[model samples]
Target chain A: MEAASVLERRNFNGLLDALTARGYRPIGPVLEAGRIVYGPIQRDSDLPIGKTDIHDGGMYRIADRPDDALFGYNLPSDSWKQYLFPPHSRLWTATKSNGSFTVAAEEIDPPRYALLGVRACELAAIRVQDTVFTGAFPDRQYNAVRDDVLIVGVNCGQAGGTCFCTSMGTGPQLTDGYDLVLTELLDGDHRFLVRSGTATGADILRELPLTPATPADCAEAEALIEHVSGHMGRMLDTDGIKDLLYDNAEHERWDDVATRCLACANCTMVCPTCFCVTTEDRPTLDGATAERWRTWDSCFSLGFSHIHGGPIRTSVKARYRQWMTHKLATWIDQFGTSGCVGCGRCITWCPVGIDITHEVAAIRTEEAVHAHR
Target chain B: MRKPKLAVWKFASCDGCQLSLLDAEDELLAVAGAVEIANFPEASREVLPGPYQLSLVEGSITTPHDAERIQQVRSESEFLVTIGACATAGGIQALRNWADVAEFTRSVYATPEFIDTLDTSTAIADHVTVDFELRGCPINKGQLLEVVNAFLYGRRPDIPGYSVCIECKRRGTTCVMVADGTPCLGPVTQAGCGALCPAYHRGCYGCFGPAESANLPALISELRRLEVDDATLVRALRTYNAYAPEFRAASDELEVTG
Candidate 1:
């Protein structure tokens, strides 16, 4: 396995077969109900080929591309968070008999997964989750699933309308946290410029028929990154953004955003790095046995801050402020990394077009004027 | 240990919520084992007397007699729970809150003089205190079972007050409004149906009613931008959970603007 090899489009299915042989269930994007979602990929046709994505604040859809190009679209509506920290998973089970109780921790047997379309921002997000789940206090379940994951990253050919990965320095080009990386070159021969990030990644590539990549292929991949960076539809200035949000605690801008914010938690639900959850115990009807589960939760929910008397964040304004401030500012202190990866999911999936980049810029602009005047 | 007595009551609804309990075929036997089904007319003909430990009331207060009946039902039960859109937020029939009921009765009834009704249809909570409210067009049977089970075990039911988008994301369903041009009420609507309509490529008609602090104005404005006519917005809001304060106010404003 060389440093840079070309896997022609014809031999793509063999790549999937190689991953299967190594006990990795390949997962990739598939079009469902007019949008792309990650599901099991058994064949090459399962990929969203010849699909061109149209993304904007509060809007996302796919149309036909003039040429057949798999992995043409940006991030799917749902991220890879579902694979790692699943929505609902049992934690433990308890059985009661003769006034005595016996408890058994939920035994986990997660599948070894090979993620096919890991974008740069998504890879950054996975790393952010790594710190949250595997930091000082490790989540046994998440660690078990995360350990078996094989991330096959992809470099972007084009940017979505709401994308700001370049601004956040998380994407358009990946740095690390990938086993294998790919650049789908369009103008040249319909082929992929595949590179290995780890030894295991090289091992899988050995199973496929590969040719050494020419200098032209490497240059084309570089040019593709520059093109995506230049044509990005959105931008966010991260200059003192964390401090700016922290300083403007009572900014009237929050009230304005609240007028439009549904507090539906769409932003958090779609955000790749927003790791928040709640636990519940499901006791059976007869009181003989009980099962416990952990489910995804959001700070935008009123009950997410429930204390003794009532919920802490009651108004939509308070909840919205808490979310943005924590995402850009407080998350750094708590997790040692920014909670947002600039995936643009929070913007595009919002029912109302409430862009975070726009919100941050608005506050920054207001503060700049006040500071000087 | 004797099981607690459970009673089911109906008011101005179609009895769909009561049917949801019967639909829980698997949980129904377990429920019967845990609680003596003293007054579930839908499941049995044996009508037990009053002072029930738990009362599951369905439907809205549309008739004058039913309004008085709900008060009696409340007094006879230790803990009263409202089930379905009608009992919680005055179901689709709450459309009459805006129109002339007398004219409607005259148009539909053969003998209009014989019909007795109130000027406005309202939720059960308007008449008596509701310990809990289960939302849906017809409540989700799983959630209904959870509620019954929770009450039996002396704990609050684990019902979420979040939007349907959470459930949609969990179920791996793409956003219908974002992916397609369909105007959906999922953002303002509460989660309970497991995002049923969105999974099937249909916009949520708000069967579960308004979520906590539902920003109807925001959603309505977004729908308007999607080229949804004002008439459609009004009609969408006035559906299953029509008189839920947030939906009611939103529809009323749209009617004025339309």
Candidate 2:
């Protein structure tokens, strides 16, 4: 068993101060523009302590929670994707001089990040992205920033209306991929059960004024995590999901879902595993200078499938099928795991309320009927 | 080698898409260096002869003379690219396709005889074979530049074919539909505007026109399920790209069903 310690609710600000003192910029949840978004954090006040978000298909809003516990809600709209893979990045710039052009690469020096209030599902999502960006070719820009970031994960005591992480076996309690793990126990004592998962985490733990966690505290944390596991708002049936999707390439359910799917790419944008990008050249007005930039791209777009002949996935049905199948089926073949962490952002963010879980269920139901026949 | 002669032509449009080239403030001088702006009445009073290397035509065919003028423009240019919703999909004026155009002309114009316009507004592709069609109400300046760059480089332009959802996802924008129940047209609409409307906390109005293989029936039914009235659904499809085949078909089908 890993070593555990108790951090009182009042002393939470100390952890932020300690992280800042160590030169790691603390980034956590912030209530901005009526939504909980991730940005710079200095103290415990930055976290949406008493705020919880109400999320449903095509519906999301911030509401006051009954208690004042940090990380008392589900995933925020923006994930840590921005910190790892930014929206826009200039790759190289070329300046024309005397009929010749000289190209220079942009300097890449990422800041040391201490990600606070990270949920288990998000950690899993990060790992999924890690496999993508650090694969055979390796994205240098992503690695430059991702290699130094420290993960501070928070175990979910309760699941959100859109949360299906338990079903995906990626959440409620993080067993790996985090430097430090925290389980907030608001029962008798307003304290947190903190456990160091890495040497760096252990070093940070030594600096904090923490007490040795008793067995009762550990048991309390265990019970809460177990309870959250069984009480998820949504569940995905992953039994042979890869095979099921592969088998149902021509499934009518895809056509049904595609009709409702706006092909808006909202799900992919909110999705933590998606990694498609397209590069464009921006030349200066004087034609003297030019720069190339890589922006996030999606399979839902027609240009994503465009070739010299024409676009392969010209229809909404085809594009939506490509997105869902890639995330659930082909991802396993490519990365040894499902692209989805079951964070349920895609389902909640879909403009038309087209639920991925529901789509899978529809296909599974059809497959069962076919099997019976 | 001499620079390729480039020209910009306008019809019945707001000239917003043509202005997009002008809006390429930083890249204008660079692009100008690569191509000679022979005839651009919007930016310059100078008129160059036809037989141009590349021509960027904006607006829809709303008049008989403009229709004839397009044929001449097509004959003169080696490559013709239609820019924006007006050129690629008949534009917002194509809303007249659903109603009586004579009634519209009579109601608006003091002397209806002076107004010589076609009953239907049609995309440039409907009249002539366009080399490429760049979608958007006011085409994205970046994409417009990409098109020009591709032309100069003798390569295919890299424009997005996916829905607005993809762009929104790239930007990490919150889904307004899920977050606020805003009935966005992003899923069915072609992407290029960088999911602009969603970032501003409003649903997309399909300013970029319909995406490839847009499923109008499915989107319409889903919107209806969301309590969007039949009339509103029809109106939604009849927006910027009202004359676009996919939107036109959907709107027309709904008009009959309602």
Candidate 3:
């Protein structure tokens, strides 16, 4: 909500202090297990400063960059989903009292999280989950956690090998859905061109020591985003992909991919928008008390489609078809946008290096060839 | 209502799966209260005759004696659930099925005549029909609890048969195969271990066995395209769930094709 300002890298620590001052716990990317992952951070030293990453199909490594920029890396493997919609959540607990039963739901209030160095694609992913959680039913648990998150988005200066946000029309630059967007300017004096998108962000920015941005500073930030947008390593021609995938129900490529798929739900897991869940009930030894739980689930699982009869999607080919179709096709029909944000997390995370972009292109190419024939 | 009788039996295993039942710790107290833990040698010396409401069978039938024992256990129990890689598949020991047992017996034992084995370490499902099979190397604690809870509630257990990829997704773990070119079996392996290996930045070892309807030929071909050698491919299949039919056939095919 404040005019774009320039904050030197030295004074960046003040920003973290300001967020923490407001009772917000700051979480950002930190070097962990040879890769950058989201974790609680108090100091700038906790960030993967002066580090970048190399990511290809079935390959990832962290490398030293020329300058020390706090957010100088591609997206981390784990998304913000875990923080918002945790892997495991206790829903309610019940106990037998006399002849009646008493049930109590788990408290929904979660800590206010100030998420630092979020990328455009990841922001898009958060929005996707937002729509899902705040749907007709409006999941109270997800809403309670999501409402308290403060998004500090970082515009990507460079693309990773698996990145394709350009094709997905999602990123490389922050458009909206962020409290503040940051563009690191390593060209001259190391500084960030900060722009606030919300009133809370403006209040936070006013607290940090900041200088009004010069015309050159704004131009530099734009140039960096333009450079990133142009150099996306992977691309998906999603012009008619929804129809393309839905029509090719019996495509030979389905059988080909099914063989390599492994049905490991890794793609959906890394995806920013996949929101399937299953419930389990745990009882006390006396069977007098029980606690119902909710955890993340994947469509690739046979039990995910299980009914009284059997699983609806019985074959690997059928299961693969269901996931792809839902992500690219039916998701649009249901949610009005593509399930994928083009972050390329699925492509980079797949054990077999099965690229969704590659799979989609193969189908589109065959469709074109068939049309010509 | 009378408390349901719960029984646990073993054959050939590290007792890891049975240990998981005890490892329930906090939940074990509740489970013990809900059901009469009739016969669990790993946990208690107290033994009870069967006609059990639910029986949790661990390990595989390696000896001629165990082959007969599983049948008696099945007859006594109304619902038989096989837990872990050993009982669901053949487990790691099932690798013996590919080699000559006679040579292994002669080499390991001082007196080969004292040993009693059926040459193949087979699953409980091979001899008797199982109501359900919980697949994993040591088995996930949450899932094992679900199986017990489902049986007590008279409903089908909601264990997933999808690959470990789903677990990786839920945990938000990056894909080890795509990120590091690590040869992983997560794609085809079942989804009970919560994608454990991948979370630690390693490829899945197929501990939960091949997921339902796993496309073994296709996954193997992808590994081959990555220039994974024939022996490595064979070794991959012959690990935790080596004797699982899907992986066993794939490994045998690669051996023959070579």
True contacts preserved, each candidate? Answer: 0.74, 0.75, 0.85
Give the CAPRI rating of model 1.
Answer: medium
Q: Residue A310 in candidate 2 has what lDDT?
A: 79
- lDDT per residue, candidate 2, A1-373, as tens digits? 4789999999998888888888999898898767888889987888888888987777788899888988888888888998899878999999999989999998899899999888989999999999988988898899999999999999987888888997788987889878888999989988999998899888888888899999999999999998988888788999999999999999999878765776666777788888888787866544668899988777876677777897888777888888989999999999999999988888777766678899999999998999999
lDDT (Cα, tens digit) per residue for candidate 1, span B61-81: 999899889989999999899
For residues B1-258, what per-residue lDDT tens digits would candidate 2 score against the true structure?
A: 888999999987999999999999987887888899999988889888978999999999999999999999999999999999999988888888778989998999999999999988999999999999999989999899888988887777878676887777667667676666678788788888988998999989999988865767766766777789999988888888998888888888888999
In model 1, the Cα lDDT at residue A287 comes to 90
* Candidate 1 regions with alpha-carbon error over 4 angstroms: none
* TM-score of predicted chain A against the true chain A, for each candidate: 0.98, 0.97, 0.98
Candidate DockQ values, in order, are 0.80, 0.50, 0.62
Candidate 3, residues B1-258: lDDT per residue as tens digits? 899899999889889998999999878887887899999988889999879989999999999989999989999999889998999887888988988999999999999999988889888899999999999888999898888887787766768677777777666666666656677888788888877888887888888888876878878877887789999999989987998889999999999996
Query: Which digits, one per residue and each the tens of the lDDT, describe model 3 over residues A115-182?
Result: 99999999998988888889877998999999889999999989999999999889988899899999
TM-score of each: 0.98, 0.92, 0.93
Share of reference contacts kept by candidate 1: 0.74
Global lDDT of model 3: 0.86
Tens digits of per-residue lDDT for model 1 on A122-205? Answer: 999999999999999999999999999999999999999989998888989876778999999888579999988898998988
